[model samples]
Target: MRFATYLHDGVTHAGVVGDDGLHALPDGATVLGLVRNGLPTALAQGTRALRSPAVPIERVRLLPPLDPPTVRDFVAFEEHVEGVVASVGDGAGVVPEWYEAPTFYFTNPYALVGAHDDVPVPPGSRLFDFELEVAAVIGHDGTSLTPAEARDAIFGYTILNDWSARDLQRREMKVDLGPAKGKDSATTLGPWLVTADELEPFRDGDGFLAPAMRVSVNGREIGHDLLSNMGWPFEDLVSYASRGTWVRAGDVLGSGTCGNGGCLAELWGRGRPVPALAPGDVVEMTVEGLGTIRNTVVAGVDLPPVAPARPRPRKRAR
Candidate 1:
């Protein structure tokens, strides 16, 4: 079942997406609470148990399905890594350690937006971009879990647009740290959350889902790829994420960007210079079986310039 959280008649609600529209869950029910309670058990009880009338999908405004506790985004696509390395130059290439394990970075969970929300160009950014990816919502808490166990802990999937400020990211990452303010603005997640069972048919013999992923800008398709092409499957990503740390209910794990032009940087890396996103441009990301999320870019906040860091003399340990 496709579960959703939305606003209707000025009130927020959690419900199940169906043929008619959306069937509201009991009052006070939230997607986060439902996941904690167990998606399969709720499915067994059926939507009829809610007894709320269906509201036309068009009438309600969709919101981020779940307000995750944390967000971990992984670069699991070899092509994306290769393209970035090539574009960055300096004779860079995919690092050997990247093959040893799935690597990820934490992003701000408070920066999340919904499917139809407006994303702003981060201040001082001239190269705004969108990353088309998919994410899994954890169903329960677990630490140091095995791959198989991690797979069973997944509640559902949602489309994620890892909004980026390329120019800012480029400069900041040169300090040997990952993205900070460059990715602090907004990350889109929604349309709705489709339960794990819904994607069962797409699973391959290798235990990975094979879903078609596509991204468009203002109605023109620019990038496309398959979810199955990732260097590491969701299971391995989840398992690796849980190592020495806990992944609790509502924690989100991103599948990173898909290859074959998932973002403008990838294309730029390949020597295909595409224009960056500007205010008023619309970005739509679609993943087969999971659904689609579309967001519009808008002008960002302008603040006072930050002062540069002062240099400090090096001190040696005695």
Candidate 2:
């Protein structure tokens, strides 16, 4: 079943996507809340709602599918890693050790954005970029799980766009420290959370998810990559993350950026600065089976006006 969060008549609601329209859930409820209660509860409630004839999906604005308790983005695509390295001319390739263990970064839960919301370009950012990715939502809570067990723990999948401010990222990385200003602004995800059962047919012979992903800027296609290119599968990454750490339901695990120049840094030379995003730019990212996410860049917070300086009364006193 496809699940989503949406806004209608100025109220946010959780719902299941149906052929006719949205099947709205009860007030003060969410997809994440349903997942935490376990799939049986979710399925039972969701299926019942879906059968209702009163709900209208077309009247609502789709939000991100999962309200994650925590979000961990993993770098598991070797093609993306290699492409980034080549763009920077750092001569750095995917290390053998990277495959030995899963590597991920923690993201701010509060920065989560809905599927059709505007993405605010961070203030002072001159280099804004987009990444096309696939992320999974965890269903079961556990630790030290094996790869086989990890697969069963997956609740569903969604498309994600890991937006970046490349200039800020480079400056911050020079300090070899926190993600701070580099990635804190926003991450766009979801039009729907497609259940694991629905995606089973797409799993390849290599046991990897093989969704087709594409990214476009202002209606022009820029990048295309296959989800099957990841070096570490979702099970491997989940199991690795669960080692010495507890992974609970509603937690999101990203498949990192895809290859074939998904971002500007990879497509254009890193040394040559690119045009900054303006107030009207639109970025659209899509993954097959999972729906598309389109975000418009709007002017950020308004700045306070500069006050006129007081008359120079201090000049005589000095």
Candidate 3:
């Protein structure tokens, strides 16, 4: 089932997406509510609402599938890491630690967006960029779950566009810590959430999904890849994340950028010279079994002039 959260008549609602329109969810009010309660039960009930009066899906303004309590983005693709390190001249290959565990970082949930929304180009971010990926929404809560069990906890999947400020990211990453000011701006998810059941047909005997993923800017295709190539699968990432901690409902996990050229940085590394997003530029991504997410760029809050770098202090004698 394709589920979506949308605004209508000044009210926000969650429902099942249908050919004619959207079917209201009776027992569960919102996507998050359904995830926390019981996604399967809520979905079953939602199917019956197909007969009820539904507003045409196209007319309503969509919101992020859920208001997640926490959003964790994991680096699962070695191709993406290799491309980034190459582009930035990081002088290192995929680390051994990356292969040992699925490392992730928590992002600001308040920075969420939906399809067709206007994304702001952060002030002073002349090197703005986008990362194409997918996000998994947790349906049931669990801790220290095995990979098999983790699969059952997954509620659905959706497209994720992690907006980036490349210049800021480079300057901050030199500190050897994780991305902060570089990535706090915003992230786009949705258009619609495709439930796990809906994607089962694409899974192979090994339970892996081999779907073609692609990204485009202003209707021109830039990068494409297959989801099955990730070094760490979504199941592994979820199970690893659940270790010694609770993976609760409405906690979202993102499959970091899919391939070598999913972002402009990678393209630039490969000598493509792709320009950064500008006002009115539309960026779109499509993943098999999921859907597409398209957004427009706009100017955001302006910042004060950047201060010049301070002089380095002389070494102190011990």
- Candidate with top lDDT is 1
Ranking by TM-score: 1, 3, 2
- Global lDDT of each model? 0.88, 0.81, 0.84
Model 1 C-alpha lDDT per residue in residues 1-318, reported as the tens digit of each score: 888889999999988888888888878888888888887666753466345678998898899998888999999999888886665433387889989999899999999998998998998999998998999999999999999999999998999999989888888788878889888799999999898888889988887898999999999898999899999889899999999989999999999999898998888888888999999999999999988888999998897777898897777765
My TM-score estimates for the predictions, one after another, are 0.95, 0.89, 0.93
Which residue pairs collide in model 2, if any?
22-57
Q: Candidate 1's error at 201, in angstroms? A: 0.7
Output the TM-score of candidate 2: 0.89
- Estimate the TM-score for candidate 1: 0.95
Error in Å for residue 12 of model 3:
1.1
Cα error, candidate 2, residue 55 (Å): 4.6
Please name the candidate that would achieve the greatest TM-score relative to the true structure. 1
Clashes within 3 Å, all models in order: 0, 1, 0
Residue 52, model 3: lDDT of 78
Worst 10 residues of 2 by lDDT: 268-277
